[model samples]
Target chain A: MATNSLPKADLTSSGRPVFLQNEIECSILSSVDLECDDIPNFPLLKSGLLVLTTHRLLWLPDNSSSSSSSSAAAVALPLSFLTHIFSTKKSVKTLFHSPRVRFQASLDSSKSVVMTVVMRGKGDTDAFLAKFWENWRARAWENDVQTQTQAGVGSSSVSGSGPGSGSGGFYTREGAVRMVGVSGILRKEQEMWESTDKSLQEAFQDLNALMSKAKEMVILAEKMRQKLLSGSNSKSSATNDDEVGSKEEMQDWLLSVGIVSPVTKESAGALYHQQLSRQLADYVRIPLERAGGMINLIDVYCLFNRARGTELISPDDLLRACSLWEKFDVPVMLRKFDSGVMVIQNKSHSDEEVFARIKALVTNPDTLRTGISASDAAMTLGIAPGMAKEHLLTAESKGLLCRDISPDGFRFYINLFPEINTDDVYLVKDYGIYNTWVRVASASRLE
Target chain B: MRRRPGIGGLQTAAAARDQYRLVGENVAKIRTDMMKEQLATFRTQLEEFARKHKNDIRKNPAFRSQFHEMCAKVGVDPLASNKGFWAELLGIGDFYYELGVQIVEICLATRPHNGGLINLQELCILLRQRKSDREAVSEDDCLRAISKLKVLGSGFEVISVGKKKLVRSVPTELNKDHNEILELAQAQGFVTVEEVERRFSWTSGRAIDALDTLLDEGLAMIDDGHRDGKRRYWFPCVSSNSTPVADT
Candidate 1:
């Protein structure tokens, strides 16, 4: 039973695929079968969901019986191996049966037939078949491989040429480079001008054209990041403080846009949300790790859509994809607060842990004296200010902390209410948390 | 002889049954009588105390002044002129038991140390005095005084009926030693003689005399720590080498 094969793909925690850095999904179909006559032991890859991507032919199981052994196996057929794609023939029999597109490809040394697939459920099947052919011929996976090699070679070559000689301004005829004053401003302007010019030109092209341009944009971002890194390294001795600051800012901007392949609705088709959801799950890993295991859904949407560039998904699509996380064995989950604010958090993200950290933060002598605002918590927690506010609010609800709303802003303090002896408000016992708070608060008042 | 019935068994069983019924009736009658006697005693004591103190309560300048002050502080009119007016206004009838218990406890606790038992009349006078003082006494302060009093004894008696209210102090033998009192005073941040007097209802002369004695004996001292003219008194329990005792 294990020897049988099916065209299937795995979904990420956010219901998106674990796609290669440059591999993009192309089409999706529900209630499809992978039938073959030659092999007797070939397990019936019964009515499952099939996905076509730029690089692989993927099949996923139907929603009803997804728990079966067949669904557990997701197989991919590399487009690089496909030698030919036979066009869909129009016949009376074809019209009667489910719409199927057959293609001939070389598996190892022999020619084999693989058919795909239109079990059209609320989607355009002919359109998907057309895209399937286009993606196969385009050979996006090959392009990614070639670009990676090109990037490797380019970096080595660019580094080999020292700063003095490599300074060929694409915007100006400055064969000679200067380090200060007007020349510095002119150089910075020229660099920005050329990059902006390239991106602008790419943006003006047709949507299909941008798919290829997106690769260049990714390459450019990577190059900029590398340049920033190397520049900081080489100029560490001579670089002034302001130059270093700007370099760091530029590096951050470049790093944010570094996602090479973002799944789009056009590519993922009817399984748009599911595939997008999976991709989102993979994407959120780094951000979630940096945010201490949780991130607001709105922030994820902005980051995801920004990384996606032109193929931004709707909020509804993002939500549906998040809602589907329960069905997959992903490491992250979608959490909704009582305030109706939603967030994507690691499955292991515990309130106890966050509350403990918050408790520590607010109880610090300095923080106790001057309560922490959302921004202050954001800086300390290394997360967005908005996200920090949500965490503080969560901690507040759990009674780990309390809020003080004042003209200055809303701030949080370690909750002393529970520890306080309301029966004796003035009685600060020497061996209790309330005593410590009173001491700290009094010290601040003196100051 | 074998066939004859035994008179000893029959007579003994009959006597035992009679004794059991007699005992049960006696128990019930005693419970009823005890309850009636307790009620009568409480009523008689209340009435006698009220009758004895009624003229003094009305004519006493200090009592009238204190009552007026309390009424003013609590936002009620003191000059209502009705006899039971204060009782009705303050809902003392409902709270009389609790207030009486508080007074008795305080008086008992403080009196064992030769601190005069503060009756309801004296408590009222002290509160009134504080109200008239530049620094007015808060309700919380009054309640604190009452609470401290309760720690002395199990039963603190108060009687409230119609417009008449009487409080009698019953001192107990559970007075704290001088060391403990000094510690409590320091912990409460009662530094100056005036502060101690205000907190414990000590006369100005008595508070000063005690402070002088404590300082002379070196058990306590007036530290040089003064803020806004309020000198902070320090107890020897807290090491002078450690951090200074802060106001808070």
Candidate 2:
């Protein structure tokens, strides 16, 4: 109840604090406490993660270390409310005691109180204080407000910015001369093309320039996607199949176009791999869902890099990031096949689900005779061919399937090795895939 | 409710499709332009990074592999031409190309016995023995070269058989019957026709036909001197404990 005095911070699925728009994390200090001696009912937040970001000071419970108090939620204090920071004094008494940074913040319009942050972990106190001061002075939240107003002014019609935009038609205005029908669409397309040409020209000016422009390009992509989305929904009954299909494709490309603040070595320093691993865990959830709870590491590398846009990490860095997941309590894991192929999969991913699908595939009458290849499983599983092959090989090892290699190429069939009665190869089981395969093969032969 | 089922409907449909196509073209153009820009910038940055850290990239095998991967994404083929800067700076191109040629030669030499199917571990040993330098060739290196050899056609491939990688250098086909027999022969180094028939629920004739095909292909051999008077067909290619590659 005392903790409710401070505003709560939202957490990602992987336990990372959900940052405000353009709020970049500056530094992280573990095992820190926020104490307010001025307020009687103030709860002394103890031994948690304190993150310094451009807009706020985030306190997240150390999920890995605190098993007993796992319910301890994260909280955020905006830098805008800070009135002053009490600098450390160089005294023998202070030197003996734990390093603490005190600051004055207003809880509401009437009450203002002094708060203390005691650092229990091994981190640079001076650097954290410097970043705190810098961030408080920088006031990055002001920029968000400016961009919000600008975006509002730019697209008065496209109010909803996310994937779930409302199904409002393009001609939704009342007083302004509205363009209707085909000519209106053509004019709108022409206007967008001119702006796109300008942005493209500006973006390609130089690499440094491109990096700065990446954010704008992502916004532009999102806006265009929203336009297409609403355009599709409003005209769903009037559009042709190819038009609807292509619009959906464009939406997909735009959806995966940004990761606003990707973790870089320059940003996270010694915690680079750790932070990257957490971010990757959150990033791969959507792609993993699309890929049936598993994806090849190589495919993830391409997708992650594409989303990151400019700050490309090496494969070694990616491997290290993925390997670090074992130390963190993330829902995703790094797996290595017996053949040395690596993949990122959800911890909840069950081989039995994949085996069941492969079982269905191989038992099909046509596939029962000719068998299925990695490509066949890839199409059905909605995963990469190499990943599908790994799944197939896993199923083979599990005795769910068997391999067939010949001029027709390497393929898999339902494993009849177990179902076979070695004592009498002539005897057919009344049940099992072997019997089904035999019946299908015999029927095909008869045909 | 907005359905039009006449001439005017067709016109509107055509106009809507045209508008969609126009918008789609613009979006595609923007996406491609953005991609091209990113790729170009990444290429320059990669070249600079490669130049500055060429020593680290060469000395560290993991770093070298990562560098190769980064180069691959930016449309740079460091191994394309040996006369270029990548060759002079890295020399990884010649290293893999030479290894590739040696792999081909070894595959050709061992074809008669292995039936063009050899264990990847065995192939790496042969490669190391054939070379005199202190430079070590790993299975990863061989795999990379083999991937590049894909340009040669469908004759070369790496197949996984019970946790073992077998490099197939010939275009021979092994159907379901042949694969099952090979798998059954994996245990105890060899299998009898009776075991194969009993295990696969196949008739004696079916088992013998598969075993005979494997024998004729030189992938297996018949050992008739058994105490029970039962013939054993041993598959050298599929056997894990056997080191027949040494004698071959």
Q: What is the C-alpha RMSD of each candidate to the true structure, in Å?
A: 41.4, 15.8
Q: Give one digit per residue, the lDDT tens place, for model 1 in A1-447.
A: 323433445555444445666565556676676654543465556667676766787766555345655534555667776777667788898888777666655554644655444464655768867777777777667676687776776577447633333242322323544455434634544564555455635532543333335445444434444543454465333325354444355335324544445555554456666666667778889878875676556445545644443233555567787887777667888876543456677877666766777777777666766677654555465543444666888888888888887543466778888876778777778966677778887876898
DockQ of each two-chain model: 0.00, 0.03
The per-candidate TM-score of the B chain, in the order shown, comes to 0.26, 0.37
The residue ranges of model 2 lying beyond 4 angstroms of the native Cα positions read A1-3, A66-68, A156-256, A356-447, B1-248
Q: Relative to the unseen true structure, what is the C-alpha lDDT of residue A147 in candidate 1, on a scale of 0 to 100?
A: 74
Clashing pairs in 2: A405-B174, A406-B173, A406-B174, A407-B173, A422-B198, A422-B199, A425-B201
Tell me the docking grade of candidate 1: incorrect
lDDT (0 to 1) per candidate: 0.51, 0.63
Predicted structure 2, TM vs. truth: 0.49
